[model samples]
Target chain A: MIDPIDLQLIVAIQEGLPIVARPYKIIAGQLDLEEQEIIERLSRLKQQGLIKRLGVIVKHRRLGYQSNAMVVFDMPDKLVKQKGEQISQLAFINLCYLRPRRGELWPYNLFCMIHGKSRELVLQQLTQLIDSCALNDYPYDILFSTRCFKQRGAIYSIDK
Target chain B: MLSILHKQLLNNFQQEFPLSPRPFQDIANILGVSEDEVLSAYRELDKLQFISRIGPVIQPNYIGLSTLIAMQVPGEQLSAVASIVNHFPEVNHNYEREHLFNLWFVLIADDEHHLQTVITGIEGKTGIKTMQLPLLEDYFINLGFQLDLEDNHQSESVCT
Candidate 1:
């Protein structure tokens, strides 16, 4: 289990690691710990699956991926796992996961995000995904993002 | 247009950030630059909002509970409704989608009770029913897109 110090460190760097020559050294100074200690603790957090990956977050829209669509699929529970693997491997699909279906209201059990240069291209890729995965019978809807309201890293605090 | 350093940084550092005492130094060595140059480039990229952060992208539903909630808001009240949802810190990502369930957001909380409470609070404040869809499975998690800088720049120049 992560102790208080490690939890605090995780919270501290959730926004980002310092963009300095010696980022750990800077973080270590601020946290009143040794730079090596900070690195070891971070490695531990990552090993424990608390920290997923240490990487850079790219702005996809600025990179020319203009079209973004959240596609929801109503697939059988037995087939979801089998088909989800196939669907997620498609080049256009970036995010694919199984989400619980809301009865009588929303019946989509599978969700995937496809991004492309245009809506038509995204739709074409979706068609390709559907045909290749043999998911023609499943009912689905494409919800294209119209506007981004809020996008920020999830901040974790000690208190609820 | 992506500069030589920008292209190299974006392509190389998106995944394998060195787990060392001085990661920027390692990058500097790879790209044949001074560590200070690497640091400034990172700062510039961040300042320009080309990258949101350089840190761990924690996996969802690991330490806490998270749900995708959608709301149907009238066109006139979108701003008001969005502001109400955005007021909560738990709502990390909020977006307007082209569907009857137009407004969608992801809420993360410490636990199930906390998650439910936030959803309830949103319902009370916005007077809109939220369709809760929590993840049941993950097929693909982080599929980072590598930008084709050449094509992207060429297209932008043509458009402009």
Candidate 2:
């Protein structure tokens, strides 16, 4: 079970941390706790796998990476494990995972999300990835996002 | 294109941001800049949505059930359907993609039963067929993109 202060910490940083030297100290002051306490709680939260990693989230679109595609592959179950690992190692692939196939309508099991400056570049990279990774035989489709309705870090407000 | 300092911040902090109480101070010291400078720069970056947030990115499927869902909505009802999906607390990311299955969203629920219930509820409300793609195997995720700050160009600021 998470303590109240821990939940408070998550809520506070849900949007972001303040851009200050002593960010935790400032948060501690607001929460009426010592700086060390905030640091310790955060560390524990991370260790417990509740918090994955603390880092910067660069907006890819803002960095001229406007073209993004979700590539789904119809991979045989036997080869998925081996191929998924290889695909994930490729430099341009940001997210690569395997999802369950949904019968005839959706036959894809392996999925990857790739981003580039333009659609042509993204497709070029995908073609190269397919050839280099020997993934040419697999049937796949790419879905390019037209608009982002909402995007944010997961909220842990739901009772665990 | 980004300024030298902005580039430095993105390059350094994207992966291994300091976990210290005075992390900004550490960054300032590393860049030979004042704490205020680092603070204000980050503030501007956040305001501009250059970075979504500076914190821990939770590992999906670790805490709750999550799935990628896609729906085919008429173009005229796109906004309305998107708003409906956005209203769900379980949804973290939602988007409109250029495909027959246009609207896509990621939903996180406490368990499989809950996930199914939510999917059913969404289908009933939207009167659209929904496709569920649950993760079967994850090979890689949360990879940060490295930007070449040499261009020194940024998108035109959108006045709020």
Candidate 3:
């Protein structure tokens, strides 16, 4: 747990960091502290792993490229970690994970995000990447992102 | 002067709230604090990394577009290509996952043509081909992290 003063500082960072010249400076003024204090507290928070990163968010669908998919693989249990690392190294894969595999319904254990300009290009790379991995030895399926009902950032309200 | 109650007041804002002209007053009533107190605390929380942004997630498909693109960038060049992908505001969330495709990032644009232009731009800059995989269908849900309970595995073996 943190004291109220530090907690207040955290609250400000979470609510919204201003986007302007010297954003931290503006935040420091709002908190009635020096810029150095805001920077120090944020650095500590980041080091502690409470704060992941601070940056702008882009609305993807509104932009274009409008197709997104999650490709899952039924990777051998032995190769989970190694294979996950390999996939993560791909510049195109934004999200990658190793979920516990279920039965035939959810047989995929490895997941990666793939995006492209056209459907043809997306599939072409998919085939090539799989072929390179000799992934034919394993079973997989691609789950596309059809709709995004509610997508938001993390909430830090649990003080109990 | 201030204590845990203040923490509760700030976190509650990030979660669920009824937006009205006098939102601060309403929150003050619930937390048993003065309206000015709630407002002041809010300004403080904004200084910390506790909250990223406070706004409705605008739809992506409305104006421009986006795709969950994937690319298998060379490990040595992953960071370089990622920076290229992120140069445009079109890119939203990017991550290094555990898979063959090492780099993953979301690209949003004003239209399909723009998405393509961005992809081409990235390809030219990095000299690495991009695979844009758009989702076909989505089943099984939940995006936001659960706060009320422990990490209860859904579908018993679903991916994160």
Residue pairs with backbone atoms closer than 3 Å in model 2 (clashes): B1-B152, B1-B153
Model 1 lDDT tens row, A1-160? 4488987787878889989778888888988999999989888777776776777877767667777899999999999999999887887788889999888668889999987877998999888988999999999999999788887877777666
Note the Cα lDDT for every prediction shown: 0.83, 0.81, 0.55
Clashes of each: 0, 2, 66
The clash number for model 2 is: 2
The model with the greater TM-score, 1 or 3, is 1
TM-score of model number 1, chain B: 0.90
- Candidate 1: give the TM-score of chain A: 0.90
For model 1, give the RMSD to the true fold. Answer: 3.1
Q: Write the per-residue lDDT of candidate 2 for residues A1-160, one digit (tens) a residue.
A: 5577787787677767777778888888888989998888888877786676677887767767777899988998999988888888888898888888888878889989888777998999899889988998989999998788887777765365
Tens-digit lDDT track for model 1 on B1-160? Answer: 5688987887678766777899999999988999988888888877766777888877777667788899989999998999999999999779889998999989999999999999999999999989988888889846366666677722221100
Q: What are the per-model DockQ values?
A: 0.55, 0.61, 0.03
Docking class of 2: medium
- Model 2 chain B weakest 10-residue run by lDDT: B151-160
Model 3, TM vs. native: 0.47
TM-score of chain A of 2: 0.86
